[model samples]
Target: MASKSAKKVNLLDHNSIKHILDESVTEVVKNQGYVEDVRLSNAKLLIGTSIIVVALIAQFYKKKFPENRDFLLACIALYVLFNGLLQLISYTKEKNAILFTYPPAGSFTSTGLVVSSKLPRFSDLYTLTIASADPKSISANEPVHFTKSITGWFTNDGVLVEGLFWKDVEGLIVQYTKEPKKSK
Candidate 1:
């Protein structure tokens, strides 16, 4: 019952939610001079998870199919290896981006904005965390997060958000971060 008291933003609308990501990136760039500094707990997790998966797969194959263990192991190893290399390449490409911790977003890890660069097709997912300084609107102390994927080849593109909502995002960011507002 208490859950109904606090409203939450839908995390599935790709178009509407894209506003948060675009505005946040704009806020950091237009106002902060393209500052790119924030902690991202997700990248490390990606590499770490890859290692753990390879180990787990090896264990599974060793127990269930010992007859063809080496061949299976080699195949799994190649797959994980390919994924790791992709992650590394994506990182070097997105060094200009910044990350922030938005709790309600997926794992609260892979959410961020790319400053001054085109959105890369593989990595650096954007998260929508709408925070407020005013106590009246949806969120004041805690931020409201919305998320949609534009990270892969299938649906990735420039984040397009409505102008009115974008203005709201700009105001919220400036209100909290003390950055100057970016004019529309």
Candidate 2:
């Protein structure tokens, strides 16, 4: 009877120890996977930013030098095309949505307005409309009157969302009108 009792105690202790070890291993694996994902995401963002910078520089060169304008313009076009394609690839791989916040009142003109935002919720669709008193002369860096409207749930409080409509310009062009929440 004493031997049998001892055997049962040893078996239970062994099972308990095995369970703890398994749990610890699982936790470690999960944490490592999360870290790897974060690193990959950061790398992608950096690559995208670099491409955009290069494209901007090429555009500036195209505009500033008229004698070599053709060459610079070609470079600018290629850069924009390549960077856009790369951005699309990254977006598809990450399954990330785009977010854009409207600009505050009194800070944008029809020519100067650009909108962009962080990744939005997968289910949300954002539609932006640009209206101006004079529509024909709309271009970046030019001053013109405009109006914008947006519809979405505000997720983060106090975080200014940045966005770009044109490839090069960045700023707030419209403001959101917050609706009151209904009491349940």
Candidate 3:
């Protein structure tokens, strides 16, 4: 797959973009270059451990808080533990893929979109970067910090990406990251 100079990208179609976001991460990971990020595995485990410590402290010392607080602490500990376990699974796959990949998948409907280009810094192609924005939210629209400069991080708006449609994102990826001829 070679990166095309004239491929076209569609940024206005929020519905189609949402459809992709709604699709299972598991299905998307079936393609090349899609890795399950476990960057916070250690952090999540540490959080769960801390919660357990708090729970233990609550049990050991009575009346520092209410009796119900003890139960609440225990419940929070359990929830964090469950999430930590799932993170551990992702961490193992980050080591190497085995049977399959799964996500503690979540869904949140957003109301807007933000599209930008990652030109001059990380990519040589006029690669596209998109983000979902919530029209109703009052929070900042700070861009996500992404590491590992890859295919989608380019723009001269250099590559028009003509002819190809946006639904074929995977194909677009193939076009952009095709292996060099020397390898063949």
Candidate 4:
């Protein structure tokens, strides 16, 4: 009888992994960006419409009550100035695509703290502390802290913490440090 050896599964190639990460990030950014654009457009339209309506009303009142003309003019000027400022601020809002790259498959030490970037709060790119099982292993069982310097993908699905073969490693831990900055 011949003895059979178990086949080892190699990790994915770096390019393949990068391609997958790129596709996923692109999809998420595009969807979110589109929603933001729609909201801004609607706000601009509403403010413009309100200004027009107010001007027309002021014109009518000015003719009938000439004494109130000065007050009406001041109100209209304020409205127009506010509207212009709002438009300027909206135009300056950031809408550029955020480029994300996933780190290559390798072992890293766990700092025991995980943090997320400010770009996407709900589901965003995160930095994690990956613990090593053996002192002689890739990371030498030290705490690994990945900053924004190390690129990674955004995933709502959490990573696996426990494995059957690793002995020195108690387990893996992942946590988000803070919420992302909210948009207006």
lDDT winner: 1
Q: Estimate each model's TM-score.
A: 0.29, 0.28, 0.27, 0.29
lDDT of 3 by residue, 1-184 (tens): 3333333334343333333322322232344434344444565577667767766765666465565675767767676776777677556533222112222134132222332233243233333432333324543133332222223322344233222223344443344234334553
> Which lDDT values do the candidates have, in the order given?
0.45, 0.34, 0.39, 0.37
* Candidate 2 residue 84 C-alpha distance from true site, Å: 2.4
Candidate 4 TM-score, true structure as reference: 0.29
**Predicted candidate 2 versus true structure: per-residue lDDT over 37-128, tens digit per residue:** 24445666776777777767776664467687777767677777767777775675333212212223364433211222222233223333
In model 4, which residue pairs have backbone atoms overlapping below 3 Å?
A: 109-144, 110-143, 110-144
Q: Name the lDDT of candidate 1.
A: 0.45
Global local distance difference test of model 4: 0.37
lDDT, candidate 1, 144-171, per-residue tens: 4433444321233432333433454455
Off by over 4 Å in 1: 1-31, 38-42, 45-49, 52-64, 67-98, 101-166, 178-184
Candidate 3, residue 184: how far the Cα is off, in Å:
25
Evaluate residue 119 in candidate 2 and report its C-alpha lDDT on the 0 to 100 scale: 23
Clashes of 3: 14
CA RMSD of all predictions? 15.8, 23.5, 16.0, 18.0
